[model samples]
Target: MQKTFKLLLVILTYFSASSCDDLFEYHPNQIRLDSDERNLTATNLERLQKQQPGDTLRLIVMGDTQRFYDDAVDFVKSANSRFQDIDFVIHQGDISDFGMTQEHKWVQDILKDLKWPYLTVVGNHDLLANGSKVYQQMYGPLNYSFTYGHTKFVMVDTNGREYSFNGKVPDINWLAKELAPQQGEVWQQAIVVSHVPPYDADFDRKLEASYHHALAQSNMVSLSLFGHIHNWNTDYLYDNKILYHGTTTVKNRGFTYLKVWEGGYDIRRIAY
Candidate 1:
């Protein structure tokens, strides 16, 4: 009987130690990650490029997973169950709550289970602590553009408040160049995806007009997608043709689905 009790005690101790290791982290800001977790943007983009182009591009846009790991898990299941035709998924930013590398990893673990390849934008929270480096390491550049089918998707960093309004964020100049028409490419539309919208208070006030004007003037720009407000909103702030769509966070259990063809697109909000 004593031998049996000793064995049970040892098993209990081992389980307790394992639980502590999982529950408590050494440092929230530590940049520890496995090989499979690194360079996710480039890896996913490679997967995206391998797929054949379709007449209409279907995508899932969601963001602000933040600290909601459980919700993110449910989100992946819901997305996978509903979106078989989606070419890719775009996370509009704030993948982590405190910009902790661990949080980013937690969210990525769930997002990787998604059926389609996924990409992310840099958010204000994602710039906190050593998150900027971690983000660049885990993901790719803060600002990037890719063309698939008849559309060009531009993902930019627009978290001006995080930069303390240094006036360089949103990188209007780079955006202008990205939005410029490429020679010999018959691009029918452009969509700008960012964490903060130009009209938001977090956006650089000085660059707001320029940013809006840039999108308005760009003939190819059809829509802009954002997430930070934690709610769903759509409007034509400048009263022009460019439409801005802001999405709710995964914590709220919602996302946006976009279907685009050569000249037009449709958007539907899904709450799951």
Candidate 2:
């Protein structure tokens, strides 16, 4: 009888340990991650910088991956099958729904399967709970810019409503500075990318004109890209010179393919 009891205790102990390690989590908001999951922005940017500059820069623009794990996985498969000469994939934001680290990790796990490196913008939903911190830790800055070939991409944080319309969420000063020198020695074209469009009610009303004016006046900024609307749209809102492209959500199984050269760009909507 004592032998039987000892065997049962051993089995229980093994399962208890296993449950602690695999099944039970202390908290859903915990910011735990492996080395492979951290500092993804810099890692991907390094890969992007190393690629040869082609005449036509082909990229996949998709976003709003919130609460859509199954669809996001399918998106990876569809994106892979659709394009071959793509440079990289740009996720416009909402990497998480509840701002949970696990959601971000799940999305990353799926997007990591892509044959090309991917970049992300900070979405309003990504600011929930400890989401902003997790996003910063995993993807780098909320507002950042990088130049590839002759094109410079300026990604900013435009989730004004999330900040209660604090008027500083988009950081117009930083954007103006980034847009000031459009025709840099190396880069001649500029593209602004963000989550919430300035036209959206979620954007800070006070800064909307300034934001649009910044892009409109920039000789280098010919196009701006955004997500959060969950619908495809193309417009020349402010000056009729700057083209703004808004992408749909991954839940809708749609994305935009962008092709840009030195002087012009083209966009196509793809649904799968």
Candidate 3:
């Protein structure tokens, strides 16, 4: 009787310990932040500042990381393992639920564990009321450009007027001038990254056609990528150019990884 009681106590202790471990595991791989708090932290700012030109760049493009924050974290972890040399990460918008401060904080905490530089584009959901201001304060600029290795990467503001239908969808003039091949430019490849595509029904029809036409003339543009559709695609808008609309980090949609070699670029999807 004494031996049986002791054995039962030991088993109970073991199960209790296991339960505690599971409780604390709190992987939160499925949790996402709200909209208002998507700003940059001291660490993310430092990483962004350290990036230099002419480095082999490996980046993960994630879409709609707001409601599916945990899934996004899972994707990030998987990406970190596969692309050990990634210089940075680009999130193509929807970083939060309501663009609230709490949401931003949650995401920042999750991303704090990542070992590489990461940045985000503004999405429609991220623009809820004061979302743009919050995002700008957190990540720096809305629309900007950076050069890496033999590529010129442009991050633009497509969600500026997401709350309404206006002619000022994307600054087409700015994009055209930026895409112009400069004298002795070492960047043989150019890519445009936007939160919303010109063809997305969210924008005004006139504005979409105008922006689309402008992009068609930019011969230097090798790839045009967008989010907001919540799925992966390879859309060819022109003969020599291709547009890629990657899926979301929500609903376990996965991420888009691009490999740019001397010959060409290859995009692959990873399920987190």
Best-fitting candidate, scored by TM-score: 2
- Model 3, 1-272: lDDT tens digits are 99999999998898887745334434322222333333353345465657663344566777787777777677767776777777677778888878764576667767766778677777888778677776777666777776666777777778745747766757778888778878977777678888877767775666776676666677666677788878776677544456655555555657877766544677877776
Which 10 consecutive positions of candidate 3 have the poorest summed lDDT?
28-37
Residue-level lDDT for 117 in candidate 2: 92
Q: Which candidate number maximizes lDDT? A: 2
Q: Name the 10 consecutive residues with the lowest summed lDDT in model 2.
A: 17-26
Residues 1-272 of candidate 2 have per-residue lDDT tens digits of: 99999999998898887735245567989887778789899999999988997989999999999999999999999999978999999999999999988898889999999999999999999999888899999889999999888898999999999999988989999998898764425888799999999899999999999999888777779899999999998999877788899999999999999999999999999999
Give the better candidate number (2 or 3) by lDDT. 2
Mind giving the per-residue lDDT tens digits that candidate 1 earns over 1-272?
99999999998898787756366678877777778899899999999999987999999999999988898899999999977899999999999989889888888889989999999999999999988998999998889988887888999999999999999998999998888987897677899999999989999999999998888788878789999999999988887688899999999999999888987889999999
Give the clash count for each candidate. Answer: 0, 0, 19
* lDDT of candidate model 2 versus the reference: 0.91
After the best TM-score superposition of candidate 3, give how far the Cα of residue 175 lies from its true spot, in angstroms. 1.2
Give the Cα lDDT of each candidate: 0.90, 0.91, 0.69
Model 3, residue 153: C-alpha shift (Å) = 1.1
TM-score leaderboard ranking: 2, 1, 3
True-structure lDDT of candidate 3: 0.69
User: What is the overall TM-score of model 3 with all chains considered together?
Assistant: 0.76
Candidate 1 vs candidate 2, TM-score winner: 2
Off by over 4 Å in 2: 1-22, 182-184
